[model samples]
Target: MLSIKNLTKIYGGKNKAVDDISLDIEQGEFIAFIGTSGSGKTTALRMINRMIEPTSGSIEIDGKDVMQMNPVELRRSIGYVIQQIGLLPHLTIKENIVLVPKLLKWSEERKDKKARELINLVDLPESYLDRYPNELSGGQQQRIGVIRALAAEQDIILMDEPFGALDPITRDTLQDLVKVLQKKLGKTFIFVTHDMDEAIKLADRIAILSNGQLIQFDTPDEILRNPANQFVRDFIGENRLIQDRPNMRTVEDAMIKPISVTADKSLSEVISIMRERRVDTIFVTRNDGTLLGYLDIEDINEGYRKGKDLVDIMHRDLFKIQIHDKLQDSVRTILKRNLRNIPVVDENNILLGLITRSNLVDIVYDSIWGETPAGVDEA
Candidate 1:
């Protein structure tokens, strides 16, 4: 948890990069700071890890003042990702990933294990671990950048326009990856971005700033429904303002309970359950119902001889929808990706339900034949 109180940063004694901004960020929340260029979103983020010393006010993490902590130790204890990525080209992927841990004197075995674990979290192959950063594509390198931040197992992550340089498709993929990672890891994320769509899609709360001032801080849904002022409303864009439509539904309204198995289930046990359920793919979950990954009949058949558990052969690369997301978003993704079913999860990656093709079909039919509801207007 982070508490920013009267946080202000001034440049050359007059220019306020961040002016009297204050925020209370909860654990595991994805918070995005957004504004036009020179609005101080990045300055506000850097102050948290003491990358930029605050000119005034204070920052506290779980009641401990960040100013009182050693800068190097504080930074190492918190994850930081940036657009440039800054991965050392000379180091191998594994080495780059565990660089912080190594600097902190982590054991070789621990570093190696952490590297492998993080690579998997981003759905990258372990074989890539031996390759250098140059060998990877831009998107691959960015994925590494993201997981490397997690290698230290820090509870808080600060990202400054991390996906800004990538192509739109790759950026979208990485956005989904980061959102899922944040939920699965239960880490607090403070992200700086100028894109409103990105903020609304990935953040639990969006903090809008202007001329270094904190304009508004609220959940995306709340902001969409009720922006604080004309500046807040205009900044978010008129097109994003939601219409009061009672017919509108969220993914939670349509999702059915998912067919899932605990990760601890053996391959044989999963196969039997799948056979009985007549489902090709089943969500693999941890004991707490965290959606760990997914297993299909093909995976079971191939890995059966290896005698591994469902978790061992499960696919971590899969699309999922948040329960509170608009049903239209799910429909768009399912149709675009040609998916059979997508898991629905809460903010914490807890398995809530699943939206199947049948569910989407029904929603589509209703949308096509039912009365049209009002929508956001073009600016």
Candidate 2:
């Protein structure tokens, strides 16, 4: 267990960066420190490993005072990850991972075994051990940075906006990976970020700070349902959490059965289905319901006039979303691709259902109002 009591940090002789903050984090809990800039979130995190000295108070890990321990040994015992990653460009990926182990005088054989194990934890291949950091992509490098922190086998991990520099897609992927790893390894993590959504998504409890004071610290569900004060309510809008939670579902969870036809169907048959279904586009699938592509009415008519079949007119370029993909990501793809609807496919490319604009609107309406969208009668 980590116990923080009246921890205070003052800089420039008088400015209290962290003013007498206190928190108790259970072992194996994922805690997030989130707030506006200058709210001392990072200061509070840095204080854990003695990266930033506090003016007063105490931090104890497993009932032992942190101040009494040697700073170097204390730091090495705790895993730390930062936004910049700070991986040495000259070092091989293996060298970077085993640096802490080498300092601890671990045998080369054990180090090699540990390196490969940690590498596999992040889904990286053993082949990456021989490559330089520059050879990896941004996401791969960030993954390396994460596993490197865990490479030391520390009980506690401190992350200071580690995914802040990544793009939305890469960041979300890393966030999911980290969450899975945290649960699997049962490591205690104190993550500091300015994003409340990230906090709510990843944290079991959030410590919201403001003006160097701890504003409110609570679980995501509690914080969303009951904001402590006006400051918190404004900082994290009441409806923000509601809007985000329902939208995080998978495509399979949110999709609806869409109008579809097999690719072998005639153009006249495709046009008839489109007219009957009141849709301008028809999903083209194989006889086995595996998505082949789509057909627009205009294309179908052109094909029919030219005596062409559905297979000749169907557009295979339609953007398809995986059933396992996050609904939020599906929404983004829809907007980015300017798509009217997206076909949801399984791992085997078999069509399951689709996410339409109406489906997204219904989800939003239900999330905000806590009810189904009103029809013309209700409206």
Candidate 3:
């Protein structure tokens, strides 16, 4: 277990980057530090690894003070992964992964054996072992960055926005990879990210920070259902406030007006509408505006170039939530479908708006408990 008490970090003059934050994270827990810029989430994360010193506080791992150990020795035992994916461009994948074990004078056979084992664990081909970092894609490199952190067999790992730069598909893929590794290995993870959806999806509990103070630390479900203040609610975005309506508002209240096109539309027309709207998915409809399905660009990109019609390549699975249905009622269907956005329909089964994963994230976080977050702005 990791215990932090009265953790504080003050910079030049009187600026406190992290102020009196205290938390107790159980072993094998996956916790996230999330907030807007300069909320001290990153500061708090950095301090745990001693990359940034704390002005006043105590951090203990397994009942031992982290400060009492040698800095070099302490770091070697704690895995760290960052957004930049700081792999040495010149080093082979195997060599990069075993940096710490090499420092500890591990035998050549042992290092190679462990390296190959982890490579397989992440489902990477054995051929990747001899490849240089430059030879891999951004997603592949980030995967290497993550596995390298675990290469040393550290029970605790700290990741700071590790997937922040990847494309949405790659980011989602990596998040699933990390969650699988976290559960299979039973490792303790303190992840830092500004994306609330990422936090809600991965963390067992979230540690919300603002102005360097630990505002609220609880399960993802609780934080969304009951924010401590306006800042928390605002950071969660405007949709978080919808839970407090007297009738417990439905997806209709939070859904966005959708931009859609007919299935018969040419691929060019579909692409044009999507480009103009800057949207990832476009709903397909019939002449009467009846819902058809939706198109995922990736699933049909090649087909689109072959002059295939939108109807030919578009997804046929019709997943939607009714406008009158309470928000919580759709949580299971939304997440179970792993959809980016779902079509919202009215009583007549006419498309209304799009209920996106980004919007549904907050609602799902609290829906299980049927509690609304605090601080609903009555404007």
Candidate 4:
């Protein structure tokens, strides 16, 4: 557990990055710090680890004041990760990943075992152990950085926009990875980011900061449904407009009607349909009403270059929530599948309607801010 009492960080005469903030972070809690630029979220985090010495107040980690501990020892016990990743170029992937453990004087056998475990934990191949940092992609390097922080087996991890540099797909993957890792390790996490979506998706509890002050701290649903003020509302963005939408509504409520696409369709064919219809995804079905897979532009391009079949490229491991399934169930499918759109299918695999991520968010917003549209009511 960690506790902050009257935490304040001031720069010279006028810059106060954190202003008299107090918070208690329980063990195994995934807490996110969110705010716009100059909000002092990062400052508050840094002060906890003595990365940035606080101007006043005190921070206690597991009951002892962090300021009273040696900075080097304190840092070793707390994992730190930043947006830049900061992997050592001279080191091999395994070496880079094992840096912290090595610093802690872990045995060679222990180090090797830990390295392999972390590599697999982050979904990297064991073959990457011998590879240099430069030989890996940005996402791979970021994974290595995460493994390195985790190498020492620290109880608390301080991450500042750890996934900010990766692409959207990689970002989502890593977010899922972090969620899994947190459950496995049961360690406390203090994460800072400007991205509200990421905060909401990953956080067990979110702490909103504005102009160096703590504005609100609560669960994602609470924050989304009942924003503390206009500042928090605007900060959450237009997505908040639909926080109250019915979760009971099905894809039938928002899906585009008329089944589309063929099993033998080529990437080019799917692309043409997407462009012509101004749609990003289409459902694939067989002649006898069997649902095959869903095709999106990205799926087409990835499969096209390999000369793969549409069915082969299609994600067959599709998760479907019925028309009457709870809205939370649909949202879960979207998050778990990392999908932007999901097909609402009946028991017979009948293609009903589609529910895009935007539509789901809109439903939530409409439930809160406006009347449910006539179409949804009918569906």
Q: Highest TM-score among the candidates is held by which one? A: 2
Ranking by TM-score: 2, 4, 1, 3
Off by over 4 Å in 4: 243-379
How many residue pairs collide in each prediction? 0, 0, 0, 11
**Cα error, candidate 3, residue 321 (Å):** 17
**TM-score result, candidate 1:** 0.72
Q: Provide C-alpha RMSD values for all models, in order.
A: 8.5, 5.1, 9.8, 6.7
Task: Report the lDDT of model 1 for residue 274.
Answer: 90
Q: Could you give candidate 4's per-residue lDDT for residues 8-124 as a string of tens digits?
A: 988997788899899999999999999998999989988877989999999998899998999988999888888999999998999998888888898999999999999999888
**How do the residues 252-320 of candidate 2 rate in per-residue lDDT, one tens digit apiece?**
889999899987777777777888889988898888988898888788778888897778778888778
* Consecutive 10-residue window with the lowest summed lDDT within model 2: 368-377
Which lDDT value does model 3 have at 62?
A: 96
How many angstroms is residue 154 displaced in model 2 relative to the true structure, after the best TM-score fit? 1.0
Tell me the TM-score of model 4: 0.75
Q: Candidate 1 — which pairs collide?
A: none
On a 0 to 1 TM-score scale, where does candidate 2 land against the true structure?
0.77
Model 1: ten consecutive residues of lowest lDDT: 238-247
- Candidate lDDT scores, in order, read 0.88, 0.87, 0.84, 0.82
Candidate 3 Cα deviation (angstroms), residue 191: 0.9
Please give the range of 10 consecutive residues that has the lowest summed lDDT in model 4: 239-248
Rate residue 253 of model 1 by lDDT. 89
